[model samples]
Target: LIVCTHDLAVTLTQRPHHLIEYLARMKKRVTFLHLRHLYEQPRDKGSPYIRKKVKIGGVEVRAIFAPFPSPLLNIFRGLCVLLHVLLFDKHRYRVGINQGDPWIGFVFYILRAIGVIERYVYEDLDYNPGGHKNWLFKRITEIAEYYSIKVSDLVICVSLNLLRLRNRWRINRVIYSPNGVHLSLFSRAIKKKAHPPTILYIGSITEYFGLDIAISVLPSLLKKIPEIRLIIAGSGYYLDDLKRIINKYPEIKGHIIFLGRIPHEKIPDLMAESDIGLAIFPPSELMHYACPIKIFEYMAAGLSIITTRGTEAARILKKYSVGLIINYSVENLKEAILKLFMDGCLYKRFSMNSLKFSVKHDWNKIFHDEFKEIESLYLEYVLIHKRTVS
Candidate 1:
């Protein structure tokens, strides 16, 4: 099989290591890899990890990492254009993924010209519109939706919210593959931590994630348990606002720690060090059907969770007895945190249950099942297209 994917499996970003490992394991059957933009650069401060060449199942993979080029140099950009112009094959199976407009447009023309393209799969991992309030994300997402729905043979979404997003856009043939974690990677903890515990909030501190709620409830929580501290371990647009809130609360000024944007690999260590994991999102269209990966990560860490009620993520938490589920209010949130401070047996139960529950939803099992299903469907679609053309 020949796989055509975009910048998705970029190294050191979005768990590309896991995908590379999985694909390399399948080399006994795979013929070629048609990848576009296989690597991604960090937002600033350069590449996230040290570059290395490692063999996965003895298969050497080619990586193309340049997204933008310095006009003075321009060599990488020039090479990318050259690859777009020159790469070709007449009889191999084709799978066009979320490659940018240029690559997708070129593949559509080439596949139609030679007429051997089997299936076109559009996989959307980031379907959150509120993720970026900027113009760049909006414009690119709009164009991606246009071509992805207009030309793909199958559309795959990593979350159920994305499937609903497809239907809203009037795109059919959507499949849901919810984001998952590797249960084995999680540190199994038999004993739970003591009361007046340390609380943790991971990921972005943006408006969409409701960092305000976390900040507002803190003063009250501190009055109740002065020993408590809320450690925020990520950075985003709302970082400044969150900092201001912390500054305003003089009693708990030092109690709030901001560890700006640490490496993703270091997140597990941070979680393991903390006693409670926190996720608080306000009500919105996006939040309604969303299933956050943080919830699973918190569970994998075996930390008792505190989250908003009524959302899909909360419902999942409620089912698993993972942690306290409360509505989006300062009083309610303060109460929930107090319960953990006051009740030891409840925290222990939640901590134990969360780790045990997360085992069934590991990424290895989830992705393996997804890949097999997609491969089968894609193959059948190819055969049907061939017969119809004949």
Candidate 2:
């Protein structure tokens, strides 16, 4: 059982897709129940939304998201969370909260009231949304983090940096499960290329992702290679900033395009239309811990990648010999893109190597591995519960 604040069907994040796909494949042996705030919750409805709780293509599945309420209407959401736990057989269900917000305390309070969910898992996806330097939010976050770590049976963090907090709470089951991509989807994208020499960038244009780097480099790149076109496939708080940057560069004014937000399934088509993928996250302490899913998607599409150094994605590229890793300078990026076009053998090698490497790390296969471990843990939990009850 998975209990989260975000609607699985309406909002598409990596976590929802991972949970939905995993449960769908293992439904015969595993029952899944996804809980969310509500289906009507206002969402970006663009690149941010991945999948929904609704059945896809008439497939009836148990991993469904139940919408509760927004904070304003969540005065009694605790009871709702409790009622769902009571509705399910305790021994057959495992509870997990996708987002570790302070309000989740209300959900767990309901779970504790019913004595149905024995173990709770908290997933920490981000360290801070706004700057961590804000005193009030920082204090609130610290307190919330403390409480979550103290109560949770397991804390599944996406980065190793989060693991540093494990010692403070005496938690032993902390695990690192980085974001991943669907390799099969990318393969199809590469196979069906609609645009030649296309350049694509998908994901947040936030201060962290450094879409500005691409915006700065693109004009010069276009000057060198007039046929080049760019596709910016995601949106965030920094979209306006990125637009300003792009507009400042007259050479790339008409060559660059923004697709706004797109569906996860639609990404492959967009990737297929591009020959090169860009991931130019800025140089910051925050970036050192990032594991961008776009790199894998780029590799799967067989596109030569241009990205910054000091990221897990760069390490993977280096290890697999799939793409070029470079610094975050605009001059370096421009030079790299030019080299990718001029050096045919290197680009071909990177493209072929990327396609081969991406197959090994597809989310479909990764989901199986994670689900198997979760199932084992669930069974172990049941055995311990029975022993205590007996």
lDDT of 2 at 10: 46
The TM-score values for the models, in the order shown, are 0.74, 0.79
Write out the backbone clash pairs for model 2. 8-52, 9-52, 9-53, 12-49, 12-50, 37-68, 38-67, 198-275
- Model 2 TM-score (2 dp): 0.79
Go through the candidates in order and give each one's C-alpha lDDT: 0.63, 0.66
Write candidate 1's Cα lDDT for 311-367 as tens digits.
Answer: 667877888999998888888888888898689999889988988888867878777
TM-score of 1: 0.74
Pick the lDDT winner: 2
Candidate 2 at 142: error in angstroms? 3.3
Model 2, poorest ten-residue lDDT window? 56-65
